[model samples]
Every structure is written in C-alpha cells, then in structure tokens.
Target chain A: MTTNDFLPAAAPVARLIQALHKLPGVGAKTAQRLTYYLVRMPEEEARALAEAIIAVKEQIILCSLCQNLTEQDPCPICTDPTRDRTTICVLEEPLDVLAIERTRCYAGLYHVLHGVISPMNGIGAEELKIRELLMRLNGGTVQELVLATNPNLEGEATAMYIHRLVSPLVPKITRLARGLPVGGDLEYADLITLTRAFQGRQAL
Target chain B: MTKPRTINTEAIVLRAAELGEADRLLTLLTPAHGKLHATARGVRKTTSKLGGHLDLLTRSALTLSYGNQGTGLATVTGAEALDSFMSLKADLRALSKALYLGELADTFHPLEAPNPPAYTSFLEALQALESPADHDLVLRSFELRLLDLCGFLPQLARCVQCEEPVLPGGHFLSPAAGGVLCPACKPSYGDALPISVDALKVVRYLAANSLSSSLLVNVRLPLHRELAALMSSLLRYTLERELRSTAFLRAIAQQWPKAEDVPSRTA
Candidate 1:
C-alpha cells in the first residue's frame, strides 16, 4: 500500500492533500504529510478512513429540535419522552450534548449553537442558529434555557448573546452555575456533579 | 487529514465515547497541549487495563500513536493515573461546575497546540474546586484569564468604538460591538448591558492580574457580583452566543440556601 508502489506522486495522494488542507485548522504541510502517510497505509486502514467520513455524511443529520448530529431526525436525546422538556440546556456543539448525556444527570432537551459568536473571527449572531432557538422558545413549552456554552471569551459572548436574545422571548434564561472551571465546557463534567446540577435546577 | 504525530504528555481524561463494542473514543486535555481526541482500542472490555485511569477528569500521563494510519485521532499507548477530583464526584454542584470548566477548556484549547498558560489555569481551577474558595470568583477569574491567554481578553481599558479609556463607575458593555463603552459611547450600541464600577474593577482584575498573583487571596462579594456581570457581558459579547453552563451555574446557585439563609459556620 506504499505510495512508492501505488501511484505516481501526482496521483490521488496529491489530490487528497489538496482536499485535506481545506479543512479548518489543517495546514497544507499537515495535509501533504498525511496524504503521503495514507499512501503507505494498508488498504483496510485507508478504507476505514474513507468509511468514517462517509458514515458521518451519510448517517448524521441535525436532530430536529436540538440541531445536533444524529442518525435519527429527533436524536435519541430529543425523542426520549422521559426527558424533561420545560428546561432546555443550550450548548455550542453536538459533542457537548453527548458529554451531558454521558453524565446521565440531565434528562432534558438541548439546543446546540454549532459555533460560538466571535466578532474578531467575524462570526455574528446571524452566523449561528440562535434565531432557530428563539423559534423553539415561541412554543412556550420550554420554561428555562440553561446556557451551557464553554466558559471562554467566545463561549461567554455566545451565552450572553443568546441570553439577551432569548430572555425576552422565554420565561427564564439562566447561565450555567459557576463552580465549574472557567473557560471550560459542560461536556467534561463528571456524573455526580452533573447529577447534582440536574437535581438542583432553578428558575431563571 | 495529516499523518497523526506520535506525542507524549500528562493529560486529564475528560470523557470517553463508546465506539462500537470494544473501542472508546477518549477526549483528553494535557498540560503541554490542550484538548484532544484519541481512540482506545478494546478499552471498554473487562480485561482492558486502562479503565481506571481513563475516567472523566482523571489526570494521567499517556503516550499516543498518531492517527495518521486511520481515523485522524490518536491511539493511546499507555496511561498512568495522577490525581482525581474525587470529591467532585460525590457533590453534584461541584461536579457540574467541574464539567463546565473541563468542557470549556477542551473546547477552547486545540489538539497538538501548546498552551501552557491554559494548562496551568485549568490545573489551578481544578485544585481550587477541591478546596472551595469563593467558587464564583475562582470560576470568573479562571474565565477572565483563559480569555486573556487565548488573546480574546475583553477590552476593559478602552471603549471598543471611541478608543477612549472607560472611566470608573457605571458604564455599559456592548455585546453587539464588543467591549466596554463610556456613557457618551453607550447610545451608539443597542445591546449593551449597564456595567457597574465594581464590575468593571473585577473585569480589570481578571483581565490584568495573574492567578498566581495576589488576586484570589481576598475576594469580596461585590467584586464577585461585578465580575459575574462583566463576565456575562464580556462572554456574551465575545462568543456572541449564550452558554448552557452559565445557565446551569445560575440554576444551581439558586437552589443552594443563601449564606444568610444558612447559619454561621462558627455559631
């Protein structure tokens, strides 16, 4: 499977590098290095990488309400009737929703922002799916919005952005309680602490 | 996809995602780098030796084989436990806060990027969580510092628009524009929050001072409140979105009896 034996230097390996380099944060040097490595990789390993990429594209879709990636439209978390509906814990990414679920402390709905607000980065409110979140609040079923974005500058900005936008639309909008490390995410909290947070939820 | 580079570091296991039946996709934050994801083959099976050291927020030293061969994620070579925020496990509020911090750290820090300042800040925050110093202040300070380290520290020294210094006393922070604004400058932005002088001071303290310095030794509630307000505004301004963790934190705070509601510790 070595590239030396597989094809000319100008073949698919070159094409793959070009493609990989376009991804966020992947430098061209990294892309080329990876493409060369993949050239030498075993056939099965190469297929696996291709498969994972395809699997996400083919199988994953936004959970209807939470907008998180899921094979299902509503996602497991959103469909579970056992979960609390009045409170929706809002987060920045799909991974965050998963992180919270792992704790088993939260049995409520969620809303994923996909990205936080960064003015310097030129990401504004319109860039995010916040307006969609406001639509969720309009139904009047949700009573609280638990802002679970990360605790960084962007995370804080994103949370405050949503609070001002959604607070007027919803009955309550509360930020995550502050004992957690600042500039951190909600996805990494342990089960016991997450459980306590779930049990202790208060009105905004 | 680049060839995954083999790397070694001391890390804290933030969480594990079950992949298929035997493998686990592990998320970790290291002292050298920041947040990263790696696959641990067959670690979910009973015979796997890395189980104890790989739980949520458990610190460990790990060697990883680059993910270049497949999956672009790292594969764990070995792991050894350092110390666990075990107490956080028993206390729900504490644990939630820890997760919030860990998640924030994981999100902000990138894999394979060296962020010693972030690493140290996270380490100190976790340690502080164990002891329970004014948790709010600690969290706010950590946030302020993290933003500073990330180079997004909110501009407390001057107004975002006018470039004039933000005078002490009641001012406003414009989330739409990004940073504090003087009274004259406030009307230019629509979505600004009224920030008190105390809050501005806390913001300055958080943005200007280092955690290793004499900041946290003596924190006042007024400062905490101000920080909370400033942080809320600054973060909202910066991220341009809301965090679920902030809401969760506020929710938990509400359930706990006020200091006045609870009897004095010595009495």
Candidate 2:
C-alpha cells in the first residue's frame, strides 16, 4: 500500500512512522503498526523506551582497549582478570563477541575491528581498528592471536591482511574453522563450506 | 495474472550489500544483462544455499525470477558457482587486484544492457589473476581492454592533440586529453604527466595483445610504477572520482614485496 494509506494523518504520528520505517527490516506496514502501538502504550512505558534510546546513544562509548561498545573506557571484558590476556580473539563487530560468549567456550580477550575490509564499500584496513589491535599486540603480553572474522570473502581478506602483519609478533595465530553449521543437513551445506570442512577435518 | 518471468544466466557478483535481515542486495554483472540488482532472499542466514555461490567476485550460474511486479528487482531462485577463483582469493594481493578489476567492470558496465565482450574480458582477467601470471600485466591489460570496450581507450600511439604519431623517446600523458601527447602538444596541456618510453611501449603492448601475450612482456618495477600511475590517472579522469579499491591495492603493494620478474617470452 501507499504511504498515505499507512501513515497517520497527524504530523507527529506520520513522522514517527517514517522514522520507524527507516529501521532495518521495518516496512511501511510494520512501521505503522509500531507507531500505533507506541501511541496506545502507557505514557510512563513510552517515556522509558525513549529514555533508554537516549541513554544508549549518550552513554555508550567504544572501549578504549577492545574497541567494543561499552559504558566504560576499557570494557569489563578487557579489564576482567579471569580473561586469558595472552590470547586475543579478533572479530569484525561487537555483536560477534556476544555470539561467541553465548557458547561459554573460550576465556580470552577480544578486539573488535568494528568492520571488515570491504573495498566495494570503500572500507579498507585503515577504516578498521587494526592499528589499535596492533598497538595492543605490541605490549608483548599477547602470545596468541585468534582471527575470528566471518567466513565471508571480506572477512577472509581482513583476516589474511592481519595475519600477514601480526604473524611475526604473535607466537601463534589461528583462524576459526569453517564448515557446515550445527544441526544443518549435509545435503544442504554449500560446496565451499563442505570443502573447508573436509580440509579441516580431525580424527576422533 | 501473468506468470512470473524466469531466466537463467551466468553472472559475476560485482558487489553485495546487506538487505533486511537474512537477505542480501547483490549487484551482478552478466554477459547478457550487463549489470543487475537482484535480491537474494535469506542469503545472509547460516543455512542459505546461495551464500557460498554469491560471494563478491564469484562467477555463478543464477536462476533469477522477476516476480515482485513493480520493483524491477529480480529474486535469485537458484545459484551455483561457475568459478570461485579460489587461488586468487587465497592470496591477499591477488584478491585485492581482482576486486579492483571487478569494480572497474561494474563502473564501465551499465545496468540492464548486454556487454558480452566486456563481460568476457572481465571473466578472463579474473582467471588470469587466479593463475601464476604477472599480476601487474593482468591488471594493465584488463584496464586497457575494458577502457577500449567502453570507448574510453586512451591514445597511446598518437597524440590526442596534434594527431601526430608518438615518437618513442619520452612523452607526456594527459588524462584530460584522453591520451599521450607529442612533444609539440605537451606544452599545450598543463595537466600532462611525463611518461617514460618504456612505460609507453608496455602500455601499447598491453593494449594490443591478449592477456596471455601481455604477460610475456616483462615489466620491471620502475616501468610498472609508471604504467600504474598513468593508468590510475586516466581512470580517475574518466570516472571523475578515485576508485576505492585503488588505495587498498596500493596499501597491499606496499605491504607485500613485488613478485619476481617472469622471463620474457621468446616468440
């Protein structure tokens, strides 16, 4: 349907609809639905939501050490004494750090590059936090550098570039293994992923 | 209601951007379609079958269905990799160069138009990059050939201004004038950059020969620098903007040592 059909006649309501529509995955219908929902919500609850958005925008800052978004300079993860300071897992974004943490598998520090090397988008290694990561490595306390960049082409390129640069300094460097996802059918796995899985296969 | 139209074509993934969650907006270059913007639904999810085949710089056979009616965007129904250029992607230097070539092709090619020759040239260039051939020569040849295909080929043998045949000692290249300038014409063009005779000969050779034959002409580091500078200037002038990949390629060059020279071909 057209914008006129979905957007409220009121200027403020229409404006809210347009703003909500700009959010990723929000269509005109979804935006209208959310806008109307907000309009019906209790004033206190709506105020809380607005205030939370403001708090996030104003209070959050990139962690000085890991470059992940945090309320503090060196985030809790970076300052955590339980973390293995000798190993650092490099990732493309802060969301990735959360994903890895969900597994409760590793206990190492993380350095978020904030983005991968994507030349098509005009983003290069310089646009990333690679320099900061290198500076952290130069402290000479880190013994292992785990490249946890995505399995995509841009991610691979970023990882390779970092590996080339940091190989000499770090005692060990490793890449996250690529393969079929857990619970995914073998027949559904893509050829590249399957190939990598076979290449990285381990014996029981 | 009319049935949806579907066409299967071989396409190279020129660029990809994230669309609403679990989907991707891809800019593809096809021999028949030239350039296309298609939505690959669910391509971002872990289970997407299209994800591996539709990566940037990959040539894949794609089945596209135009069913969104007014959107003018096609949805990818099926995809299989034709050539992933795995060897090229394995090396950071080669991968950067290949992406640069893909960007150039995307820039020169227009959407929804057929450009089989340009498409073929691009595919061949990627294949050449995947091989152990000279990276510099492959790039130069691709640039020259693509410019020729797009009718932007710079004048190398003759002066762009005086129309006199260029003498083989030293000349100036004016990207604005769209080619090399003879000694007499050099004074007229203030933007003309000095070009060595060796660099001129190499460019001319690359422009004339196929990618394989072009690789036979061994380019020393100094000459390669001259050629690269001249080509970069010409491209910047043509596009009226600097390509993003150029800086990345330059950074890659500075980080990695140059590959050893290949032996000059005898025939």
Best by TM-score: 2
Tell me how many residue pairs clash in candidate 1. 50
For candidate 1, the TM-score is 0.53
Candidate 1 residue-wise lDDT, A30-95, digit = tens: 777888899899999999999999999998888778888889887887888788999999898887
Q: Which ten residues in a row have the lowest lDDT in candidate 1 chain A?
A: A178-187
Q: TM-score of the second chain in each model?
A: 0.85, 0.92
Runs of candidate 2 exceeding 4 Å displacement:
A1-10, A27-33, B1-4, B68-71, B259-267
Kindly list the per-residue Cα lDDT of model 2 for residues B1-267, writing each as its tens digit: 543588899999999988887898999999987799999999887877778889888889999998656346899999988788777787888888998998998888888888898898899999988788888889999999989888998888889998888887768999888899988888888889999988888888888878878888888888888888889989999999999888898888786765432111100
Worst 10 residues of 2 chain A by lDDT: A1-10
Q: What is the lDDT of candidate 1?
A: 0.70
Q: For residues B79-121, could you state the per-residue lDDT of candidate 1 as single tens digits?
A: 7666766565434455546767776676667676778878888
Per-chain TM-score of chain A in candidate 2 equals 0.93
lDDT of 2 at A65: 92
Q: What is the TM-score of chain A alone in each candidate?
A: 0.77, 0.93
